[model samples]
Target: DEMAQIREFIEIAGEYGLAYEYINCALERHPYKISGKAAIKLLEVGLLMGFKSGRENDKRFDRR
Candidate 1:
């Protein structure tokens, strides 16, 4: 299910063109320091793209 969501996100990103390219560049540039603001931005993007947080009634994917 998680993999399917990821694939869907990728497809959405592809449809958005340069948006995903910027995201990929950001990710690549911050491979080791993906915390704080960068992390929040990524999460915001994923949520905006309709990717589930997998936190609802599913502790498996919860942060804590």
Candidate 2:
């Protein structure tokens, strides 16, 4: 079931021309830590693929 959902999410991201690497990375690193709402927001903003670590990535997502 979880795998199905992940596939579905990848398809949805593909529809938006979003890459799957970040999602796959997040899944690999923190499979059960992601929240549905956060995922949706990330997708909505086209930031799902921009997910990264460290200070630079953090600054990129920070709101002014």
Best by lDDT: 2
Question: What is candidate 1's TM-score against the reference?
Answer: 0.33
Alpha-carbon deviation at 60 in model 2, angstroms: 26
Which candidate wins on TM-score? 1
lDDT of 2 by residue, 1-64 (tens): 6555567666765533223444545576774677899778766655544543344546766444
Per-residue lDDT over 1-64 for candidate 1, one digit per residue giving the tens place of the 0 to 100 score: 5335455656765544244434555555675566698788876775576443333554453433
Cand. 1 Cα-lDDT: 0.53
Error of 1 at 7 (Å): 15
Query: Which residue ranges in model 1 land beyond 4 Å of their true spot?
Result: 1-31, 52-64
User: Superposing all C-alpha atoms, what RMSD in Å does each candidate have to the true structure?
Assistant: 9.5, 10.7
